[model samples]
Target: VVDLEAIADQSYQFVEWTGDNGTIADTTANATTITMNGSYTIRAEFDITTYTLDISSTAVGNVIEPGEGSFEYDDGTMVNLEAVADEGYHFVEWTGDNGTIGDLTANETTVEMLNDYTITAEFEINTYSLTVDSTAGGNVIEPGEGTFEYDDGTMVNLEAAADEGYHFVEWTGDNGTIGDVTANETTVEMLNDYTITAEFEINTYTLDISSTEGGSVVAPGEGSFEYEHGTTVDLEAVADTGYHFVEWTGDNGTIGDVTANETTVEIFEDYTITAEIEEMAAEYYQLTVEVEGNGTVDIDPDQNEYEEGTEVTLTAIPDADWNFGEWTGDHKGEDAEINVTMDEDKNITAVFEEEPTDEYELTIAIEGNGTTEPGEGTHTYENGTAVTVEATPADGWQFSEWTGDVPEGQENETEITITMDMDKVVTANFEEEDTTLFDVGITNYDEEVVKGENVTIEYTVHNPTDKVVTEDIILIIDGERVVVQEDVTLEPGQEVTLEYQWEAEDAGEFTISTDDEDDPDPVTVTVEEEDDGMDMMLIGGIVAVIVIILALIGYMMMKGGEGSETEMEEETEEMEELETDEEEETDEEELDEEDETMEEGSDEEEMEEETEEEEMVDEDIEEEL
Candidate 1:
């Protein structure tokens, strides 16, 4: 018997079987087998019971009902499909290449997917708009002169009217509206975007003019004035014999020229003007100013003379190479110009002189190592003015003389006085002081010495000066001062040597110096550990003796001579060994002697140099004693 079972899952169902099968087998089964018969097998089949539902939009709109994705559903299950319009579009309908839809015109509908299905949601595009505007002085009505957005092939009504003093002329822009309306009202179709404007004309007005009793109106005939809108009208105020025009008032929106008595007015609306009048003032007299130099004079006034109470500004100008000196006559001030009122007839003079011939420039130049007060460079002074220049020397130097354009015969003095009538350069010469008095030098007893040995330091002091001296003499080792001799006098070219012994404790450079006006060059010595040559030679000799003894023993053992006892052979071997070792020792001793001899020779040369140096020191010490 064969067994068979029907398997049904959430997404699939077992439909049937094919090929080999048994009488008791089921057509649909999850696990089944047929009875064995001549190598045969049965095949089971499965059907997808749940199908996927895919939702999508044609434009940027969303699928509101079943969110965009594949959804699971059983066979013949119905899903509600819907689409929402985005900002600039409208949902049209639901469509597909496969699937059964309930409605074709509806945004919300039911879709039955007996098999796999795919569909699209159709949407329609929306419209946009352009705007229009008119400058000041008018108004627009209705669909008016503005932007309007509508669906394709939509009609919009437009109208235009103007403000109080303006009249509509014509409609302009966007191809002159739908109808060629020359009137203020019209209509347009918004097939595409559009911008438009309505033009208008301004109306005219009359301006009236008048003035105070002391003044009269000149331009515009002094009466009611007429002009088209935006036309310019000239206005003038004429003052009578004893009057002056002050200001204008009354409906004068803006004065064309505020500084003059006459001006023009623009008429956009009706207006009236009035001029204020002021009384006349007292009379003034003329004040004449004269100049006596090659220069110019400037005065501030509308006329040659100013009013009695007005203050006039006077300025004096001078040409190059000239300077303003003083203001003479009516004004007693030393200034070049002065302000005065025209109370009476006055005469004044402006005096100027040639600028003082370019002041004399005195320059001091330094030649050597010294500084000059009234320091280097130009110093300005009037003609015949006196300037004193002094030269000061720095340390280790002295001012010797002065030269170059200085006062006659004053070139040899440290300080010189000169009359600066012309530009002059003076040079100050300097010389170094005669400080070479004593020649002092110090040296170490040896160039190279071993640490822990005593090193003798010798200082040589020589009186290189021509004169004799009884002064304190001091010796310095490194930097520490040690007294040598006090109140000792010596003839010219006399020299003395002082000595000090110092222990060499550290291996390094050792220095010796002395204290004198002119200290001589110092000397340096080096200290270090000394090598022991004898110990090395002894070690070498011992090693050679051992090698020789070993070689003798090996030679005797390999000889194999006839009829020899062990004791005698051994004795002979000892003697031969001893001889070889003695010969080696003698050679080693000779090498050692040669090494010592070489070392002694070098030491002897060093001793000779030291002895010579010591003898020279002894002679100098005797002279000091």
Candidate 2:
């Protein structure tokens, strides 16, 4: 905190201190140290009063020529003004265009050229003497030269040359003597209507300034200032060739030596607010800020915010060559974290390891024609519908758990079902030979019967020799087994019925077998219903005889019941009546009826008696003849 008494009433307060120019320094005399972070303040001033006037020079004789050397006061001379500073601090160097041959130390100091390179003087704090007339009352300067036509001196330092009862206003000379001489002006005018009288007074410093880059044996990086009477420290820019320091007097305390040409003094962000009570409107105070140095990066941060037990990937890429370094933050449950390091900077990445997993299948298969010539049959662990392969370890071999796809869960001799869904060319593979075999006959049945009752079905037999043989036979119906008939004897061509009860109720029109249904004799039977009409013919003959017998017996009973013999007697009587009624010579039919009756009766002998009586009588007469 720089508290300069001169600036205690001003809006801006100046801090002070001094240091080597490029090295470092505290800016204010009241400031003690540079805070670890953020802006600082500085105030600057340049004193021009009470400076030196030196003449280390060269002179040449004035000659009347076209191109000659320099002189002054019109003695036909042309000369250069070459002076150096002698008042001992940082000074603004002067050249020929402005005032020359001396130092300038007032608020507006002036050094004029005079008398052909022969006159030079300096102004320090002294008596204020305003004299136009050449008369001295005290330390007031009085003119020593007489017979003055026009004098060129107007005003003197009023405070440095003031007598007891005089505040010198002008330079008054005798009645017509002109005075044009002022202390801090560049050129004097011709004496007009001015007087030259001597008056004097005393005073102190007029304003305030500080020399922060003084040249008082200051090191190459320090800053300071110099003055004639009192002192006020100022901010002077750092110079590379010399040291920089600060000059102060009165009672503006608190300045220190520090590092960094630009140092910032701050706690965190602290600021002071001071105000006076007599306020009509508000006011604001400010300072000019300077960012003085280079090196172009800034990094300041707080705590990290993430999880404590999660795996994450971190990648770092730098603009420089950096080695493997230690981890600063947390690494949850990461496997190779903290234990691993990156030896280089690149687009680097990492991965984690995994564990191994175990799987097993079985199959049953038939190879070859699958009909009369089945070649090989097998049960295997590897063969399946999808053909899964298993690592089947043999009896003495120890099993190794597989890491890839297997047939089953490492089980051996498992039964698997397989079917022939289509006509296929198949091969049965196995790890070892099977102990059992399947017996399927290749014999087929051929039966010859009449066309309405029996159809001719052809068959074949296989694996047979010329002997009485015995084996198990499997007979299949449709696609399943209808019979498994075993143990049979046959004399080659001789055959017997392979009787099978019809378990199937419906007599289906059947394809007795597939071409691959058997390797043996294949049989098929067609049963039929028995005949009716022959018994009807035999019962019809017996019914015809019983009808003929009843008809003959009825004809004899009708003749007896009608009385036909009595009718015959009555007919004989009628014939006699007819003969009686007939004439002897004309009725032949009547006589025939009478003859027929008399033949049936007693007529001829008795009729002859009458004829004899009549003959006796005639005999006597005939005797007379």
TM-score of each: 0.26, 0.17
After the best TM-score superposition of candidate 1, give how far the Cα of residue 448 lies from its true spot, in angstroms: 46
Q: What TM-score number comes out for model 2?
A: 0.17
Model 1, 314-340: lDDT tens digits are 788999998887888777676655787
Question: CA lDDT of each candidate?
Answer: 0.70, 0.31
Q: Tens-digit lDDT track for model 2 on 1-625?
A: 2233223322233444433212224344443434333344433432222222233222221111211233223222233433333322122333334344334332223444333232332222222222233334333333332223332334322212445433334343432332233331122233343334443322222222222332321221232222222222222223222232222222223222222222221111111211111212222222111111211111111113222222223432222332222222322333323222222221222222221111112222422212111223332332223443323334323323332122344323222223322222233323432211233333343232222333333333343345555544345565564444555545544444443322333333433552343344455554333222212322332233233334333543554546466653453353343323222212432343333224412323432432453344345324422
Worst 10-residue lDDT window, candidate 1: 616-625
Instruction: Please give the RMSD to the true structure for each candidate, in Å.
Output: 26.8, 58.4
- Candidate 2, residue 602: CA error in Å? 75
